[model samples]
Target: SDRKFKEILSKSIHDGHKIYEWLDTDEKLKLTRQLAHSVKLIYYLKLQQQLWQDYYDLGIKDGVWAPRISK
Candidate 1:
């Protein structure tokens, strides 16, 4: 399932379109939800990467993972 999701994401990223080819309407909705979830995670990781870099630059070794203040 993870590999399949990665494949879809890679194709979508390269092609600049939704990854819903060959799927029925219901299946397309489900795939859309899955893709949205994956996108959220990717956004989160990118934000975290930026935060880590900022912290490292400031020499901050420890900090709490506060969701409300993340963005």
Candidate 2:
């Protein structure tokens, strides 16, 4: 829904490569590590959401003492 995302993607692919021409090797490594960390964080967040979804779907704890879950 946001055009900013498209612009950022386009700019990164088309014009972002220019930065590497003068960037230091250490800086590049750091940037790549940051990207990898970001990906791993997103993966864990998705897994956490899925785990909650699985718990809700199972409904095995629907006893009188169990907390009620609303739609």
Candidate 3:
């Protein structure tokens, strides 16, 4: 799954470069907004993956633990 995710991320980034080379100014503005949203989505996915990893490392077998963020 991680490999697949990496492949998709790589392809998306490559496609972004291609788009940037061709799109006009107006389109680039719209793309900038979309890219900002995508960054947030990526952040959320990484946070989720880290939470799952922490749970696994803690030997949380039962689906009863609530994940909390550490400052």
TM match of model 1 to true structure: 0.48
Tell me how many clashing residue pairs each candidate has: 0, 0, 0
Clash count for candidate 3 is 0
At residue 43, give the lDDT of candidate 1.
Answer: 100
Mind giving the per-residue lDDT tens digits that candidate 3 earns over 1-71? 33343344446675654543444366564666577579989999999999988888676557566556699
Residue pairs of candidate 1 with colliding backbone atoms? none
Please give the TM-score that candidate 2 achieves against the real structure: 0.51
lDDT of 1 by residue, 1-71 (tens): 64475466657675534443534366665776687889899999999999987877566435444334554
Question: Which stretch of 10 consecutive residues in model 3 shows the poorest summed lDDT?
Answer: 1-10
In order, what lDDT does every prediction score?
0.65, 0.62, 0.63
* Higher-ranked by TM-score: 1 or 3: 1
Rank all candidate structures by their TM-score, best first, as comma-separated numbers: 2, 1, 3
Q: Over the full model, what C-alpha lDDT does candidate 3 score relative to the true structure?
A: 0.63
Residue range 1-71, candidate 2, lDDT tens digits: 12343344446665754544534366664675577579889999999999987787666555424557799
User: Which of candidates 1 and 2 reaches a greater lDDT?
Assistant: 1
Output candidate 1 Cα RMSD: 10.6
The better candidate by TM-score, 2 or 3, is 2
